[model samples]
Target chain A: MKKCSQCQNNLNYNCETCILRLSGKTLFYNVPSSLLQEIEHVDEHISINTKIYEENESNTYLYSITKGIVKLSITDASYKTRATSLLTAGMSFGLEVINKSSYLQNATSITPVKVCKIKLAREQINESKSLLENTLKKWQENITNQNQIIEKFSMGDTHTRIIRLFHYLKENSPLEEKNNFYLPRLEDISSIVNVSKENCSRALSKIKKMKEIILVDKKSKIYKT
Target chain B: MKKCSQCQNNLNYNCETCILRLSGKTLFYNVPSSLLQEIEHVDEHISINTKIYEENESNTYLYSITKGIVKLSITDASYKTRATSLLTAGMSFGLEVINKSSYLQNATSITPVKVCKIKLAREQINESKSLLENTLKKWQENITNQNQIIEKFSMGDTHTRIIRLFHYLKENSPLEEKNNFYLPRLEDISSIVNVSKENCSRALSKIKKMKEIILVDKKSKIYKT
Candidate 1:
């Protein structure tokens, strides 16, 4: 290991801009203070429906959220979008820095979102043991979640997957909506359910036939009631 | 961060069963030798078709591959099995050990495989920064692969998904077979394609009709020629 003798000395571990302040809690709560001060970060505000980053871009930085929501998505060779997960306030991303990760998905702001960006340098990876641990924990959680959806649709039918997704949206609540939940682009929902847009539409129509969700705008919103 | 005074002094960083030695290379390449010695691990062999562990079983140790192949998979509430990825000779698993992770998937040996199991204690987590980093990198790669599959099939067709998955299997070569390859259990392949067994079979028939794969046995094995 290349231990930089001068790295720790005079390093600012406890700056006011510490990500934890905005995130409330984080995976690195236990990261020793001496190690924490060596890190640096910056925060920014993004508009609703903005593309934060794409899978192919190697921007060399990751984000921590202060407010709003971000949707992690992917597009295949055919140019269809699929929603991987939704990031809410107090969440952070970009663990790929430790491994020089080549991103294979797109990250977009679902609502006007406030986020903090941090530089991940080679020597600095040793500084955030907490962040790396957090990445593993969250990865497993997402994998489990995806498997449940796959299992729910094991009968090879799209209807159940769509129903479950709707149930998930109602339970999870997409952004700032007590009564006006906007369904995302059909393609996004389709990816989450592991089906195609047409299957997602068919599933949505099946739900409509059952009078479960009222498609208010005919484009995306669903009435709360 | 605890900085155990006695932790590094007597630790054994190098042993015959060392994970790095067996796996050829790993994320721990840069983990300080002092820290590496503080953690302990063991090597073991698993039989073909044997489950190394499951989502609910807390065996408390994780694996690093030395030989053979392991399938990281999940079984949904409906009893359908999905193989998420195939881990071969140079990989490791068990990031959940750091956080008492609730596993939502199962790890099974598809072929006879050798692995090193390492105990992950709270203090040891601080000691093994390299392992944690590797876990995050591998997790992201798997997630990326999954989204691509979802994206490739975004057209809402099961046949295309199966065809893509077949292409993937052929290119990736999850196991060692010269002229003939035995397709995994239909249910496992179906889960990867995110379709039901019936649909998977139908897709297979279509492929056979196209003269792409020749089924020689009562089970699903295709002739290379």
Candidate 2:
């Protein structure tokens, strides 16, 4: 049994016995155990900043995050990079399998990450009721989450956006205890919230001074007070 | 058999012969003609500023726009309303049918609108491969489109955001000629682009002064010169 070096968890690529599935925090949670056991997947431990997939690349597999966070972004027509989403454990990306189209965003791991990659053919998905249901459900949830995040950041000043972003991270983190969670790099946070790194740093300091969040371990561990 | 009062076009609720189907610009385009013939749908003519659906309401049916535009927005935690999407003809909304969940945003008619509403059950979608395929494809496109809009708007200042918003609207409008399109009210445009109405108007004036866009007919018809 190989162990995941990043999270130090014993790694099993099988879906049926996976810890994320056991904890009921995976995209396949609704899938029946029998079907889960029949599914074949590969688990990969990705180092920080590794490119999981590139925009416009051929998307052949759907990826489910097992540990750590991944930033999904795209370089727009103006050559500006904007973060579209931050997917953590239990969420999935590379949903272009449904359309068999190219990836629309570049996905890169923001932390040492573990992902379960499943090659889900469109026909295979259409054949399995549970899998199709779960896929569409995740797709809907992803859109809703993105919309909410955009709404949150669009409504406030830089500091307010930073505060809302932290609150959002705290709410979405998969940790059993939500008091503490891994914070992505300042650059990643600034990109996600559409603010400059300096502005984000200033906002973070203000938030800390206001006692909203406590950053420890050189800002890696963020605690919501 | 009836006429759509909003667009002044002949209306047919049947999926097989609908104009949007022939134009290949609808969510159900890929469904088989046999299945399309069997599907029952309703055509509705909605007045301007009408609330099509409220956020968190039970989502039972999916709506395909046949004419005009609709705005999708949500009130954030701070009670500020943020527009998430602006859907024009041939686009669809109320996608929560996939999960049988509540609507995630409040959808309102930005102009006199016509929609073909379909009650799509999850089992019905799973039973038909093409319908499921089309639904998933639309879902993927919707997310991609939303992300691109967010990315484009996040790149620059208020004027830049408004310009990007118009370019987006021009690209998305289903008119046969893209040289001109209906510009939503300043309030709607401001909300959609995350700027104040005053700021939006000021930016529009600057754009007009630079001849980037020509606003005509009481600022309703916007022409790209």
Candidate 3:
């Protein structure tokens, strides 16, 4: 873990400067500078290798991915794991605690990662009314988009579903072009789409042949075109 | 539609009196009376047979269910319809448009309904920024809850999914011990679970036999003991 030289603070997540750089064009565009200062006190740094949150454990802090990717996944009574979504730099996670007592899923860092943690209590949240409202608004928008993705999977055919997913990723990507995207592991994608690994491979191959996307490797990489 | 005798305004959605009655012991108990007044407004009343919004339509208003039930649903490109969730008295809907250009689903009155519609770009929302912020916070919480339900359907078995749904209703319902609840048609429930009508019926019957719940009719009803 690295520490901030100026404030002598352990720096695991992005510094305020880094957040300004990554999210400046998107969600951070309209946030007032004074409001950013309010967040400064709440930020704490963390570093994790590979797996992070354990299943069925209490989660007390929310994290913003600063330098790497994290996978949020859930397991059933039979111990079958299903990946729900992926969080990368500039995205937030661990908000399920607002509705439930404990984390329902396990979140693991897909790579060696740095995350900024914000400790929140209900009373503290109630005090920072405006900031809390703004955060909740962003959270709601993210969940709505996720629900739409689930709806597509439930209703659309495989080809249509893949197309929809591609479009969604392209529209939402921080990158300039869909073809230049950073893809997650094939297993993670398969878990999200609820398809067998073999099926996911075939689907990817089919799409690749059509020039819809390009796969860099059979496992952990892809580039959409 | 009946009008409020006190103000001669259309009495639909939750009136101030109704809200006071419902807020007795819920999470909303501490919401200030002045804040409630600030958020309250007259809304149009719609009959149960009327459709509040159509698939792919541009939704321009946000609504709070006051007197009856509403169903939020969507149709695919092939015109297959699915109910995403049901909203009852005291719950709000149509918030997906907050940051989007248009709505992703259709909302309809499941029973003769009264809904207080908020004009997001005009009215009290603009004048009272704090009130608006609070409203958005509550709306965001609702969306988060909806996402959890979607996640459950995507990952859990039919039985577990049903249990989760029942638990959610029980926890959120305004009335305790009166677990008898009203919902849309059985086909609507099938759409939400992404299962065939026969499969949904079988699942419900299985749960009923297990003493988990009882259906009062083939459509438009459900109850948990």
Go through the candidates in order and give each one's DockQ: 0.40, 0.59, 0.20
In the predicted model 3, the residue pairs found to clash are A179-A224, B13-B66, B13-B114, B14-B66
Error of 1 at B119 (Å): 2.4
Over B110-170, each residue of candidate 2 has an lDDT whose tens digit, in order, gives 7667898777777777657667777887788678767755666645688889888777767
Q: Quality of candidate 1's docking, in CAPRI categories?
A: acceptable
| Model 1 alpha-carbon miss at residue B94, Å | 2.6
Better of 1 and 3 by lDDT: 1
Task: Give the residue spans of candidate 3 off by over 4 A.
Answer: A1-35, A41-60, A65-89, A95-116, A119-133, A151-187, A196-225, B1-29, B43-50, B54-61, B66-69, B75-79, B96-104, B111-137, B151-183, B196-225
Q: lDDT of each structure?
A: 0.60, 0.75, 0.57
Model 1 spans > 4 angstroms off: A1-38, A128-163, A174-179, A198-222, B1-38, B77-79, B125-136, B148-177, B202-225
Best by DockQ: 2
Best by TM-score: 2
Instruction: Return model 2's CA RMSD, one decimal.
Output: 3.5
Candidate 3 per-residue C-alpha lDDT over A70-159 given as tens digits, one digit per residue, 9 for 90 to 100:
667766434556655655666666654543346546787654455666554444334444444445555655554454545655345556
Query: Which should have the higher lDDT, number 2 or number 3?
Result: 2
Ranking by lDDT: 2, 1, 3
